[model samples]
Structure formats: structure tokens, C-alpha cells
Target: MRLFRPSRRAASLSVVLAATLLATAACSGDDAAGGSGDDVVEVNFGYIPDFNGTSLLAVAQDQGLWEKHGVEVEATSFTNGPLQIQALGTGDLDFGYIGPGAFWLPASGQAKIVAMNTLGQADRVVAQPGIDSIEDLEGKKVAIPEGTSGDMILTLALQDAGMTKDDVEIVPMEPAAIVAALSSGKVDGAGFWYPALATVKKQVPDLVELAENGDFEDTVAFPTAFVAGNDVVADDEEKVDRVLAALRDAIAYRADHMDETIELTAEFNDLPVADVRADAENVQVLDLEEIDGYTQDGTFDTWLSGMQDYFVQSGQLPEAVEPSEFYTGDLFLGAGE
Candidate 1:
């Protein structure tokens, strides 16, 4: 049996559904979280319902951290960021936990990033063992999901090797399909996120980890973050701050209780605890105090700006936008305060 959920990997979260969700968000009013009183703010939050940074939101819910911060977090499950950001833009959602699409949605004026949830450390480039380095893969076939952290990191790794996408044969495939293609040696290499990446490694132990975002820490910054509606920052900055404060509490709690964090997230995601723990080990979960260091330093800026350039180069985006066009750094800087 496969270790990961195929539903999460499937393209059920297509852009067409993003439009439909945006059009009918007003009718889907089922509540998911909150407190009894009216004074307590009700935040209808959206997230992918699986392991990964979604676990942090699970922590906040299980620990009652949202209530502690004078807000009620109503959780909604959206399979992808585009749909969530569309709902956010229409004022149906207060916030979303998302991946690389965080930058693109914001570039289009749909979302504003208030806090980062985790780094994009789980995506990796794996190849046949003999192909030792990224440079060795030039002129070879590599499969990946277009417009994801995996593709972005692979592109960066190749560029760092003094080559470009033009140097390789790019075959677009879904995560599970990439796993099969790479394992059978039908493709020279592939890029994937955890569980899928982990799956392929277990199935073929000799696969070379050609390069990942971690390899280019000096030049790349890929993060998954808590994105707010652009309108929320403009209209209800107070509520947005409250959500940030609650997330700060969750971040601190996660740092101190890794074992328990793993257990809870696995249960919340309905997966084996061991699977969730393995995935957890692959990420750098940021804490409240560390937030400033990431934002005040150039790392955060480099990540968002770099991702924009990657999107444009990949043709996922038409052109690059000023950081201000897609991001609100001030909101993230002041999230904990």
C-alpha cells in the first residue's frame, strides 16, 4: 500500500474549481471552529487537511490557542492555495495556510502573507545513483509538477549547476506518477514533496539526492505561509493580528513538544503517527522569537522575490510584480507584536 494520500496529490484542486469555489463561497456557510460569545472574533480559516504545516493549525485547534487569543478559528479545508486565495479575495475566508502558490496569488492581489508556517524543505530532487550531481542531469529527462516548490527547487538546482530548464527535458507529471516513472527509470530524475519523495527513496535506496532547496540556502528561500485576504489586512488588521498571536502560541508549543506534536497531527490528519513524524523531521518549524530574524533579515525577502522570478520564468506567471504588489512584509514583521 502507498504511504501517502492520493487525494491530496490529485489535481482535484484545479484552477477551474478555484473559480467555482470563489463564485459560490457565500453559500457554503458551515461553521468549523469558535467560542460561544459574540465578542470573540470568528476567523474562517482555510487549509489543506493533511500533515505538513496544516499540523500547526491542528495544534492551534487542539490546544485551544485560538480561544486563548480572543478569537475562534473556523477551519475550512481547501485542497490548494489558489482556491483558498480566491475565497480570501472575496472576503469568505480570513486566512489560509498555503505552499508556493502563496507568492503567485498575492502577486495577483488576491492574498497577503501575514506569517510563514514552514520552509519548503520537504521537496527534493532524486535521481539514479550513478547520476551523482545536478550537472550530470543536464540534457536528461526530469519529471515534476509544474509551478510547485519541487519544480522551483529543481530549476534553481539546475541553474546553480550553470544550466537552465532549456538544458533538460522537462516532463510534467503528478506526484504519484512521477514516483512510478522515476522508480522504473523511465525518467532520469524527478522532484517531489514528502511522503512521495520518501516513498520513492524507500522503494529505490540507491537514488541520488541530486539537489534540493537546502543545497542553495545562499540563493534560495522557499516558504509555505499563512496568507490572509488582501482585504483583511486593510479592513480588520486587529483580527489578523489576533490570528498571528494565536499562531505564535502554536509555534512555541510545537517547538517544546515535538513528540506530542507528531502524535496529535497524525491523529488529526488520520494518518499513521510514524508517517507524520517522518515528514515533521524534514521541515524547519519556525518559532515566535525566530520570526523577526527571518523577516528582519533578508531571507524572507529573498524567498518571496525569488519565488516570483521562478514563477515568471516557468511561465506560471505572466511577469514579475514588485514585492509590494504581492506581499505585505510589515504585517508579518508585526505579527507577534
Candidate 2:
């Protein structure tokens, strides 16, 4: 069985390099608690297996790039973005990779999005072959992580097909459980990201891809980004900078060395290399420039507004909270500049 390992060397290096970067940027001061050469800053980051951004994190750790930059990054796996955001708010985590929906909690004054990490077309809602059409999902069981980007997309697809959530039995489950649920005939459809989607399709050759972001016009923003607590960012600006810089390099490496990145990601996730390669076709690796545009847009703001509206209509949140409160593009833009 493939197990996950967090890189101690990378994490330690990230902290140290972060301090140096901040000092070089002329942003360091006594109030900033400037660390001596011996202080080891620890940054805990959360990631999900299926997200393409995780590959970058895995590479950064395995390669010790973060260490070269003087920062320490500990990457942990979370079941989903919501849980990851929850951890960020409670200070159990320093940073994490999450979908656009993560802005909701942060907008509610819980956390903040430090940087828009990666943007790409990766998520897909797949159904059994015979059920090619979304309408066919009626009376069928569909599995998705509740309140996730996938779930929202699934809902939109259903609505577009003149159907509603009531038309199908929605089951809440993690990506790992999705394949089994479909293979066992317990679920007629599932909304998931690449590697997991590839695994499910491999087992169920007749799987149908119902919908993806690329299929929808005027909806190009899928802000899957790295977020940190406000306290974390304020307490260690240098560390945050180093983390972003390392990730920026990792992203570059991913774009330049697709095969190697895919192989490592496949190994990290314990999936076949061919499966990872196939999934790579849909993965969008964002550079610093692209990430800047994504965060500036009202894309995340608009999405949060839509989600808040949905929550209010569904009785999820008390009412629509302010979107600006949840997200701040300062750190993301600052890092790129």
C-alpha cells in the first residue's frame, strides 16, 4: 500500500529561506520576530491527493527546493477543502490547497486565501455509460463531497438538464470511496477530480463524463488555491514568501517536466503512470502571472456570492456574508511582484 510522507527537510528549509527572503525584501524588523539562524519555523500545509497542485507540493518536498529557500513545509492530506479550511481556521494548519468554495468560511471571518496556487481543468462529474445524459440521473444515486466545487457543478448540471437535487439521491463521500461506490453499483454517478476519476473510469470503462468547467462558457474561474490563517501570514510574512517562491519554482518544473511530474504524482498517489499521464491532459498548471489574474477577478467573489445564495436558499448559512472579508489578494500579488 502507498503511504503519505511529509518532508521534514523541505519544511525546515522553507522556514529558513522565508526569513531570509523577507529580510532581503527589506520588510524585516524587530517587531517581526526576526529569527536567528537556528530558529526552525514550522509550516503545516494540507493537500488532497486528486488535486494537481498536490503534485507540486510533493515535488517541492521530495526535491528539497523549500529547504534551499530556508523554509520548512509540512504537508498533510485532508479529505476535502472544507475540512482543510476548518483546520486553517483553528490553527491546526498553517496553509492548505483548496477549491474556490473555501472562500466562504474565510469570508465569514474564519481564515484567508494567501495565494491562488493552481488553476486548471481537472474536476469532472462522471456517470455510467448508459446514463449518458444528466436527465438519466433521475432516480439514481450520485456521490459527491457535499458543499464542494464538484457538488456545486453537479447541481448546476442537473439544473441545466431541468432536474433538481430531489431528482437524484445525493450521497456524501470522499474521492477514495467514490470508485468503490460506483464499482459496487451503489452509486450511479460521482463527481471527482483526475486520478480518482481515472481510477473509476478504468474500473468502469463505460463511465461518462457529464460536465466540466471547460464545457461552460463565461465560467472559466476555478480558483483552487493555497490559503493560510491571517495570524500565520501576519506572524511570518517571510515564511509565506518563501513557500510561494518554492511553489512558483515547482510549478515551473511541473510545466517543463511533465513526464517526471506525472510519474512522481502517480507514485505519490499510488496510481498507474499511464493513468496519471491521461489525467495530465486536463490539468492546468498556473504560473505566477496567471494566478495574479485569477485572484484579481470577481471570480472568487462571484462564486462565493452564488454559494452564499445557495446556502441561504438551502438554509446552510444564516445569510449571505461579505465576500471581501473571506479573501485578500495582497499576499498572492505581493509574492508575484
Candidate 3:
């Protein structure tokens, strides 16, 4: 577990470091990862194992929705959003179901957000039996997936609790490892998302959930989106739209077949079906108006702006980012149409 301190961090550094190296890495005249192949699009979509971000896409793939849309989807699992953003920048990944952190890539001219996905209570801070509340996290060793939704939510939760980085010993680790470290008593608490959190609770039935996205003011859930590299968006616009449409279709299918969808998500991630089902409840698939509202009414802007501010204030980002520059409602609108 790696700990992130304010003195040694840059929120947008992942995108910044890889931007120049990967911006044209895909421009070698090679077809994009999701480029047309024999009249079918080849999509290399990256995602984490959590239910919120990967569930619908997995539903799409499992139900053959991608093929129905004349696309072949290759789903790649990543441990965290930052790694997915890295692959996206390198052209190895065409699209990613990523969190607000990856949104920074687009703000820095590294990628594009095709459509908003879920806005739900997917993230939480789980503490050992000894810790009961956010205030209990103070002076404790806390683990979080650095540069991810877990990290962001933890930051906000700390602020809400009237705490700061100095209060807790931050341990940055992969989601799985966070659970491992916590279960083994290496850390007192961890900030992360489900269904991993579900696994932790099973292992430690006495674990306490300190906070989640809903616990914060003016927030319902953490935001996630279908993000694509600029090159993929530039060269194969139709593929992007088709992918978004497939996701929309997947969302509907999940609604119609809730049990089957949950089971599939559980199997895909090797998590308990009950865990998947429970976490699913916290995830809200965005509707047309909600998707459009993200950009039209400053919904997405507000979330991204707050994330940027937190990053800058925490030294994760050097300066503020203009949310409008990296996000768009075009694919979202087209999919709805």
C-alpha cells in the first residue's frame, strides 16, 4: 500500500505524463483499437471490477448487444481508473468506463467523455469494528485507491468530517489490496467502492461503513462515464455512437432482467451475487434528461469542477481545470435519439 501525501502528488499528473508520449502513439497509421474491422468495429473497452461502472457494459457484451449494433466488444478489466486512463492514453484502450479522475484526461486534452454512465452511491469508507465514524478515521491508517473515486470520496468525506490529510495516515492501494490490508489489520479503514467493499464486509462482518457519496452535501452518487481517447473519437465517430447506444441498450436490458444482470456481473467479477445485487441498488443508470443535464445544466460541470478544486487544493492537481473543455453531450444525445 502506497501512501499519498500532499507534498508528493499531482492529480492530473497521470494524464500529463502520458499525454505527450501517447497522444500520437495511436497515430502510427494503425487502426484504432475499436476501429473498423471487416465492417465490424473492434472495441477495447477498459473498466474496473466494480458494479457501477462495469455492470451495464458487461450486460451489453454478455447479451450480444455489441454484435447487434455491428460492434465487437473486447472488455479489459483494470484494477483502477488511473491504469485505465494510462491504457487509454497509450491507444491500447479505446474507451473506458471511468470515474471523475479520468475526466481530468479530457480536461488536459488527453481524452474525451463520450457519455455519462451511472450516478449513484457506489463508493464508501469501511472501517474496522473499532472505528465507528468518519471522525474515527483520524490518526488511523486509511487506504484508498489513489487517484480514483475512492480517493476523491475520501477527500470529501474528510472535509465533511472536519478533518484533513494530516489527520489520517493515507495508504494508497488497489481496491482488492485495500480490503486485504484492512482485513489483516494493516490499515484501520479504507475508502473504496463495491462490490469489493461487499467482499470486505463478508470477511469482517463487524466492519463499519463510515461514509459514502450520499453522506456528502449536494451529492447523490459518484459519477462515472464512458471515456474515449481523442484519436478514437476523431477517427471513428460512428463507433463511438454505436458503443454509447449499446450501453444504453444494456441499461435497458439490465432493468428488464435485473436478476440475470446481477448474476452476470457477479460471475464476471467473481463476486457474490448478493454483493453485486446490493451494490447495484446504489447505481443509477442515467436517463436522457439526466445525461443531457450533465452538460446542459452544469450537472457534469459542477461535479468535475469540484473534483478539480479538491485536486488542486490537495496538491493532486496543480491548478483548476475548465470542465467544459473535456466533456461533451453529443454522443449522449445521439444515443438517446
Best by TM-score: 3
| Alpha-carbon deviation at 310 in model 1, angstroms | 4.7
Q: For every model shown, what is its TM-score relative to the native structure?
A: 0.75, 0.77, 0.80
Runs off by more than 4 Å, candidate 2 = 1-37, 101-103, 293-324
lDDT: which candidate is best?
A: 3
lDDT tens string, model 1, 182-205? 778899987667766667777788
Which of 2 and 3 is the better model by lDDT? 3
- Candidate 3 on 207-303: residue-level lDDT in tens? 8888877776364246788788888888987878878878878866776787888888888888888778888887876655556666687777777
After superposition, candidate 3 runs with Cα above 4 Å error: 1-37, 219-221, 293-295, 335-337
Distance (Å) between predicted and true CA of 226, model 2?
0.8
Candidate 3 backbone clash number: 5
Q: In model 1, which regions exceed 4 Å deviation? A: 1-36, 49-51, 74-83, 86-93, 100-102, 128-141, 180-186, 296-299, 306-325, 332-337
